[model samples]
Target chain A: MTILVKIFGDLRKKIEGYNISDALPLNLQIESNGIDTIADILNKFSIEKEETYHLFVNGTYSGYNKKVKDGDRVGLFPKNMSLLYKWYFERNEDE
Target chain B: MAKRILRVDMTKLEANFENFPADFAALGGRALTSTIVAKEVDPLCHPLGASNKLVFAPGLVTGTKAPTSGRISVGGKSPLTGGIKEANAGTTFAQKLGRMRIAAIVVEGKHEEDDYYLLKVTNDGTEFIKANKWSNKGLYDVYKELYKEFGDKVSISGVGIAAEIRGAASGICFNDPEGLPSRYAGRGGLGAVMASKGLKFIVVDETGAPGVEILNEEAFNMGVKKLTNALTSHDVTKPGGALNSYGTCVLVNIINEAGGLPQRNFSSGQDDRSEKVSGEVKAEEIKKRGGVRPHFCSPGCVIQCSEVWTKPGGKDPVGVLEFESVWALGPNCSIYDLDVIGELNRTCNDLGLDTIEAGDLLGVAMEGGLLEFGDGKGALKMLNEIKNKTPTGRILANGTAFTAQAFGVTRVPVVKGQGLPAYDPRAIKGIGVTYATTPQGADHTAGYAIATEIMGVGGTADPKDTNKSDLSRNLQLATAAIDAAGYCLFIAFAILDIPEGLEGVVDTLNGVLGASLTVNDVAGYGQQIIDTERAFNKAAGFTEKDDRLPEFFLKEPLPPHNEVFNVSDEELDKVWGT
Candidate 1:
């Protein structure tokens, strides 16, 4: 299955080969194995699911283990963007 | 000395100290200002007249070492909405007022003559000065001149030429941390109210004054510690949080992506060009230009989300370009250039106009075919009209709804006569309820349902939920209390999620006043403040009919999700009732 990953805020710098200045939600298409969760997808990208980052699947927040189907939209934000989203998520200080 | 009230009568050219009345002893900030205005000012009187009184008050916790508590509430009958108004700003003026043990400054009685005066205050006493030398000057120049005359230790609250011309959108400008006249109680035409009294500026010098008296020093310290911990730990209010990194304009992308960004005068929701003026770009630009990204508007602000945006080569520093200001001047006006937006924002500060209202007016003017969309130069030209007081400028200065009416355009997005801020009510239903039902008239801060509806501050509510009146009500009640405490509204980001932070707020108030106020009492206190403002509005002839969004919000379906404001009128009425 193939899914779209959008990185926003400071994490945009982490998305290799993406221009941080070129608009926002720096997009990249990722091919994934069957029924991959958000965590699995980030793992594939070599992106650690750090405590500072918030994951949003489609417009709502999604946990790392939440399953993603084909063409699922995912947004990853740093601590700053997570704070900006004001999305209610427990902070995992162990990051 | 007991807390005092300074009454300045422009008509008599006299400044005198009056004993703080016992009835207002417990009241502070908006709670005191609204109570005084409701009791003294005639509701039906013209807002920019002698019958209307302008009140300045620091919140109960203002002068203490309380983090982000340096907010001042300026209240009066609004010339913009013709209703009770309290617009707040983060400035050292409030800290000075609080340290001096001055509960409130009530400016009443219009000047019979055509001269302007400045009210200067020190710990010793207050004096009125003839300010004719700085007449008709922009606040930037006025602040610089006043700074030179009084030294940098003084805090200034002044008006620009727009206020002198009685522009309905004019707001009282205050000096920021850098002594620039940028921070403002920038809503409801309170500057016009001040200018109507023939007062040009207020200088507060708190040197040699004892700081605010804390009744329970230990309790206050504990409370401050708790709040500070919560603020520093929270992802939002932390030192290097999103707000600190990029300022409030960070929301430009989030809201734009949600299809609720209100573009080109609410004609559309999403604008691809929005990212050009967004926080991501803004932060990058500020860094590239060697500007201060994480700046404080006032002293003791833990959440330094404010910024000082300097021009290329770090030459001229512009004031903070807030998210709403960016939205108003950028996406809403279809002008995507940050440079243009910053210029327009500076014009608003210089002219003492509300940036939100000024931006809304430009959009409305565009909708009325006065300017072309995306024409940044044209928008600047329109603002120049207000500065130059051209006939067109005069009409535009009155604000969005009035400009729409003058142009015979019916698609004005306003409630209770004040223009809507950045949010589109149709796409975000919870805030729509707030925009409709709040006493302050289309004000987003009045009941920022966006916190929950979009940002998930307190609890995530479906933005499209009409039954979330309970959420709006709870937030509104708590917000009133926060406003009364003189804490910056940003503190809500921490306190709403961290229960201890809210308790800390209550503790600070209790320690300040020597009262046994529980956390539960906050809601009730907020309710009382709202009830007071509502009663004033009702007395001023507002009805259930007045607590409504413009007709187009209900009738027109916004794009993307194609949602209309689905909240029933009954649900909106239930906001105050509950």
Candidate 2:
């Protein structure tokens, strides 16, 4: 099963000519043969599973190691000044 | 001869002028207020009680040749957050007062009766005037009436209807060039405490007064030129034009694009309706209406980031509606109409309230079905109640944390009863640290972690990387120090790119005070200020547990972003690592 990976913001700038609305069309070409676990998904971008990155799967929140299903729109995000969605996980360090 | 502090003992109906404290001479802004409050005011006292005090201290550069330094801070035990809050705003009147050699003014004690009064601080002396004619008025009207009597040139700080009602989200409004009462120490509800003291307004008249004297004119000139040049040359400060136009609202699309924009109250990162409320759209509206953008907050400001927005098609600006307020109220609450948002923003400004906290509560209310999502008119109605003192007004006026508690909503985005700003912890992990760590209670400016990711000002932190804990800590400390100086935080964008920008500010300070304060001194001062606030919070019954975010952050996963609040409390404990 191929999981959908969506890159955005400055990270998106690293790629060429990717529009925001159509991020999935660009993700369909990812081969599912070698990478299957959530850890493998992060490794593609020099990331680690416990690296404090906000993980997103589809339109709902998911847990780490949750099997990435076919066509899962996974968005990787960085921290921001305008923190709008942070209440979903409050167990983190207050700093 | 500098004007002395105007000290008032409201209970005794006595007032007097006191010389500046020897230790406070070198301190200004947060340095002065926090120092004075920590030493003099009892931190453990009830925020609204007589033991609590309000200290108004301008930035060190304020009234001096430094540009955009006319900002002032009002420090006290915040009724909203129940923490030490140092609220800030740009006031031209503040600069005029500072020009008269007044470093700060303190208001203490509770009034004997329910009668409200006004405080007038002029070059001659301080006096308490009868405020019977202006009771129950919003800050805009309050300033208008006072402005007429004060000859329109005086600096004024006052509370609004919400403040008079003693709500926690209440703030204090100061005068701007346009005199709309648009600027505020708009966080943590210090205004309510002032109102509790039976003081509605503080008028400072500096007409025909000499501005603050720079100890060394030559060094000051060099420092000012280099600083202004460094600021103007940076991309964010120079080319972005975001500051001059939409102010911080320009970050809406950028953060949304980064997949970090908290939508519908931490449920998702994208709201879709964000476009209709983007900074570009606001700029277009203001442009079409001949509205002014990038207006200075105070005199001598080189980086004019404040906007003078008019009612869409009108000539006079209704008020300032920034990025934080726009996101907090519009998408967070699922409301989209910019006009209605503007009305809500204006109402908040007049009420001397924190727009961020109020919007978060509105979101919670929407989740609980008290108000429907996307009902812009509904938000307008609820905000209208605040000024009128309805039950709903009382609930919403207290801030997001309290409102969420009252409504039994568990998915609250708050810290110490203060509403979280526009970032979601599940999406942007570093900003989560900032929201968690800031002494100011869930404020972004305390540590704007996004400056690295979205703004590209600092070393790019993978907003997705867990390593941001250390990164966020450094930024938070740096930001705390900057806030202490009362310098505009937007300067971070410039200093992040040009290190000299930071030097210019410090050099200017050294020249003024005849001190050899280095950049390290400034950074250390930030940590010191945080330490002071922590000591205050510790005395006020807060512990390591109060520092944590709301519990819902641990249970709920933000949609489209599967991130959890994974930073361990131990990791947080290590943030202020020695």
Candidate 3:
């Protein structure tokens, strides 16, 4: 199974060894593990929780705990690229 | 120097200075404009007729050291909406008016002559110059010539070919810091009201002018410190933040990803090609072309989201390609290339047309079989027709609804005769409520429900929540207060989460007015401004039925989400408790 991952803004520079020339979405081949969530994908890529602000799963705003399966699309935006700080902070407080 | 109002009577060709009314001591910006319009102008008067009055006002904290507070409000009966309109812009022109101690400039009576005139206001007095030589020219060239003639110390506000023809899509153009004719009070066709008065431009020279007076200096300082801290510290507004790095166009990718970015005249939401015109892409292009990014529309703005979009290798700057401008002109018309969008934006600036209205009208023109979608060159030609005052140009310049009716198209995206902004209401239901119920027609800034509906601010989080009447009401009230205070609406993102920031705003107001106004009074102040405008709109024959989105938005299912704007009419009417 493969999950398509897209990184936006300054997050592109943060990922180690990621080719900037390859501007298309990064495909991460994942074994058939039903437990794999967005957090696990971030962990696989070594992206810290603080490094990401907005997360979208399949074009819908989502949380780190949302499960990602094959053929799913996930997009990540960095903290500096944060568009809506209130929602990010408020949702964090609730968590 | 005591604050005063400049009353310019076009019929008599006279300019008079009157002492600022004691009753209006606390009013500025949108508050002052709406109040004066409601009190003086007959609501039923023709918007572009002799009876209409065009008002220009600076905000309460405008000329002061308040960060990001340099905003001006232009108010009058809107030729587009046929309702009371107050359109705001951030520019040094506003700051100049504020420093000059000119609270408001009311332009009344229409000139009987066919010639145009320019009103020149210095610290000494005001003079009228016959400006027929500058009539019918594009603003970009006229602005440079005016600056050369009047010198660098002056700020200008002028109309262009669109206003010369009294186009309903015309907007009042102002100068940026570099004296570029880019900043604008760019909605509701207030420029037509100015043109109908035969007033081409109003130039303000603030040389030797006395600045705004702060009654309570200590409170003002403290408030400024807190608000500045909030703006500089907030993740979304601070240095290196989203706005600072990519400008307002940063939302191109964000909104597109959320499945709310309208494409091809609201026919679809969220196209993959939208990334081609994303803020990140634009920033990269601006950097490569040596264009200016993270630029400010006015001096002293902390959130410098404005930029200069230049052609390849950085020639012929076309000012900022704002998110709404890019969306309306690019993706909404199925034209995704930034270069094409830049030229369209430049033409809009040159001709003094509202980018949103022009883009929406172009989309309608496309649907009406005037041209094919994605024909960027064709769109440019239509804009030129407006410049030439061709018969087809007249219909196009009247705005989206009128253009749609002319073409026999029924899928019109307008409310109160004004075109919708960038957001697609079908996906974001709360903003749909705002587009439906705002007295200013389909203005997104009238009530930016996206902050709460999408971003989870102001206690509402669900985007699809149909019961958003209360949310829209609260946001519209807060927005009115912010507009009156002269702070840019972007500041709301910081102040909403930062408690001290909100307090700081009230403190600054109290410092300026020498009257104690708690945060509790904020809503009431906003309510008063809105109530005044509502009364004017009600008197102007706008019934509850006016507060509605087009039928297409209700029935058509937008792609990606495939959701229609299902917020019931009852829910919409509940926005104002009608």
Candidate 4:
């Protein structure tokens, strides 16, 4: 499964060897095994769970446990880049 | 130098200083402004008529060394919403008002003639100067001329051509740190209210003025220390933080990713082209072009999210393209180019138009077949029409709902006659609740639910859940308190997360008032402010039906999510238990 991962804010610099796409969503295509959750993807990129604040799976705010599928679009934002923290965190708890 | 109220009677052409009412000692910022407006102004009075009074008040801790506390609230019966309105901006003008020990400046009665006057305030006294010479000019040039004539040490608040014409979209402009007419109380058409009084500008010179009095110096210092620590230490507000690095526009990509960034006049939710105008791009452009990032709108703001956007090589500066401004002027119109957005923002600043309302107006104009979507030049031309005061421009200047009606656009996104800000209600349901229920009309800051949850003021509710009433109501209450305290809303992010930071806010208020106030009393104080506003709005004939999103928001499904605003009317009414 090919999952397109996008990094934003200060999180772009935190990832090793990831080319920072200036002013654009930094897109990194990773071959995922479909079984990999967002947390697994974070681990794969050496990004700590705490470092990632707002996680979106295919444009909908998702949790770390949400499993990735083929052609899934995942976005990760750092804690400092937090915009809608309540909605993201509270919505996740409900799910 | 006790706190006093400067009452300018435009009808009599006289200004007088009155002793501040002891009953209002605990009130400041939005609380004081709203309270004064409610008490004095008749609710059913025509918003742009002689009966409407404009009140400006600085926050309680504004002039003191409270980090990021420089804010001023402008309150009046809104020409846009036909309801009580309080719009605030962060500027040195607020600090000047605070330092001068002026609790509020009430401009009452309308000038009988068409002639405009400037109110010059100093430590000594107040004087009125005939300001007919500066009427109908762009604020950028006018600000420069005003600073030159009045000297560089003064803080100015003025109206532009839009206000002169009594446009409902007009906003009161204030000087930024660089003395650019960039900062604005830019919502609810307060500028028209100010202009209705035949007032063009209020220039405050605070030289030799006593600073804000701290009644309990020790407690004040301790509170200041705690707040400063929280602001500096928080990852979001600290130096090199997300805001400092990218400014508020950082939310462009984030909101876009969440499929909530309104695109092409709310026709869709997300667009790939939104990246072209993202904060990251703007920040990089600012760095390369010798523009300023991490700049403070007012002095002593630790979370300096403001930036100066200039042309290549930094020729002309349009102070700080905020997140809402960028989104409203950029993607909402399907114009993604930063340069075009910059010019549009500059024009809005110059013309004294709220960018959010103006953008929404242009969107409806395009939808009504007045122009093609993404026609940046066409948008500029329409703004020029406003500057020229053409009939078409006049229609557009009355704000989103009026423009939408004029153009026969049915998919109007507004609540209570005011234009909705950047967030689409269909996607961000919580903010939608705020947009619908807030007395201010579609203001996101009125109940920023994010900070509310973190502050633990409102117990949590799932965004997907229908019961977001508690979330919105609690947030509004807490926000009212913060607005009254005069701290920047950005401070809420830190204070909510850090318990000591929230306590710090209460401590500063107690220190200033020399009254004992605990953290538990924050919501109660906020409730009093909200109750005053609610009473005023109720007296103005606002009903539960007024607290509603447009029918289109409930009927039309936003893209990506393909979700309508499904929160029932009962749930929405339950927001205020109406």
TM-score for chain A, candidates 1 onward in order? 0.74, 0.56, 0.71, 0.80
lDDT of 2 by residue, B299-362 (tens): 6776676676677566546666788888987888777777878877887887777788888888
Per-residue lDDT of candidate 3, residues B83-186 (tens digit): 99999999998999999899999999999989899999998799999999888888889999999999998999999999888899999999988888899899
In order of lDDT, best first, we have 4, 3, 1, 2
Instruction: Return the lDDT, model 2, position B320.
Output: 65
Sequence-dependent TM-score of model 2? 0.84
Candidate 4 CAPRI-style tier: medium
Clashes of each: 0, 42, 0, 0
| C-alpha local distance difference test of each model | 0.83, 0.71, 0.87, 0.89
DockQ of each: 0.27, 0.06, 0.38, 0.56
TM-score of chain B of 4: 0.98
lDDT, residue A35, model 1 = 42
Mark the regions of model 2 whose C-alpha exceeds 4 Å error after superposition.
A1-95, B449-465
Ranking by DockQ: 4, 3, 1, 2
Cα displacement (Å) at residue A20, model 4: 3.2
Runs with alpha carbons beyond 4 Å of true place in candidate 1: A1-4, A18-24, A31-43, A46-74, A83-95, B449-466
Lowest lDDT 10-residue stretch of candidate 2 chain B: B449-458
Off by over 4 Å in 3: A19-35, A84-95, B449-466
What TM-score should be assigned to candidate 1?
A: 0.93
What would the per-residue lDDT of candidate 2 be over residues A1-95, giving only the tens digit for each residue?
56677543334433456753332213434556666555566676665444324445553333456456566666554322212222223222211
